[model samples]
Target: MNSITVLGSGWLGFPLAQLLSKEFSIKLSTTSSSKFENLKDENIIPFIVDINNLNGDIDKFLSSDILIINIPSKNIDGFKELIKHILNSNIKKIVFISSISVLKDETTPLLEIENLFKKTNLEITILRFAGLIGYGRNPAKFFPNGKVVKDADTPVNMIHRDDCINIIQKVVKQDIFNETFNCVAPSHPTKKEFYTYCAKVSGLPVPTFDSSKNESNKKTVKSDLLVSKLNYTFIHEDLMKIVF
Candidate 1:
């Protein structure tokens, strides 16, 4: 059996471990002690680890064939030490769960971290995910009644949490390494239409968007590379189905 160590076990990582545990031996970590029992009960070897302040035998957490970096952190001060530790370990492959925010015109700290990983010739796969939505993370709650937002006509790039997990699994199983995958739903729903439907379905007040905003300001992330490269299909491609 293949052993995989997931560095962070939060909203996306916890469910990901649950789904992959059936086949692969999952060694999961969390920053919270309260989650240990639940993870252990699910047959996951749980460890309390904080990436920002890493302590204990780092080897114990990384003693696996593969490592999945799921922690979302803006601090990269200790990141070099973390990289050194991973390089010293026997673990060879890495799957870094990144956000699409790095693509924005502004320079982001995550991009710097990613560039550092690219500099090292390690077998790493960077999965840049779009706005994540599913279960408790409904987009309807973000905009309140009579709230005015900008860039209403821009395309919304989003993916269901389930799809994110599925895409990660596919990348691991296929041994896809040293590549970047934009993990997003194929549907390109305009912000106005999508959020309007969300508010209507959830009985929330519909928010208005400024139509005068420049179209160039809006950003749309494409996952054509992910689809073609991974040969994967999205389960929830339409935002309409997502709202209902």
Candidate 2:
């Protein structure tokens, strides 16, 4: 069996590691030793990887057939360092789980990062994901207690944890490489609509916002290529309806 190493096993990696266990020799790395037992009980090899500062030497770890990077870092400079180290490895395929936030009000960063991966010799699949909701890290936490945006009608994008794992699995099986895909559900609920749903279920008051005053513009990433290229299906189509 091929080996798969997940760099992080927090809210997202927890489920991903579990899913990969059946098919691959899975190793999960985390900054916290407290979750070590949880990883061990799941029959996964766990490591304490302090890569948050982008200092994790991944050379030895890249011996695996597949590497799934799921760490959280908004600084492109840090990510650039990690990639600089990783691109030199003998690993054949790498899946970088990036965020749609990379696309939020900033094109240059994603563009530069995408260019770095695209221009590399390694087969890189960059998955720009939407707001991850469901389970521990819920979206409701951000828009808490009577919070509202002026452009409440602005489109809100979200994806469930299951869909994220499913998409990654499909790519692994298909050997899809050197491509970037969006991993978001098709639902484009307005900010008001989404917050209202959250408020109702999360017991928070949904405050009013003059949506016309909202000037923020962002396009929710679609999974069309993901569906066509990898033959993947989303567990949650209308993500907004499913999050709460």
lDDT of 1 by residue, 115-173 (tens): 87888868999999999898788888787666786788888898999899999999999
Error of 1 at 231 (Å): 0.8
Highest-scoring model, lDDT: 1
Residues 48-111, model 2: lDDT tens digits? 7765464444666555777888877545676677677776765667888887776665665655
Model 2 — which ten-residue stretch has the worst lDDT? 51-60
Indicate the worst ten consecutive residues by lDDT in candidate 1: 35-44
Q: What's the residue-level lDDT of 114 in candidate 1? A: 89
Model 1 pairs in collision: none
Residue-pair clashes, model 2: 3
Residue 127 error, candidate 1, Å: 0.4
Error of 2 at 56 (Å): 8.5
Task: Please report the candidate that would top TM-score against the real structure.
Answer: 1
Error of 1 at 104 (Å): 1.1
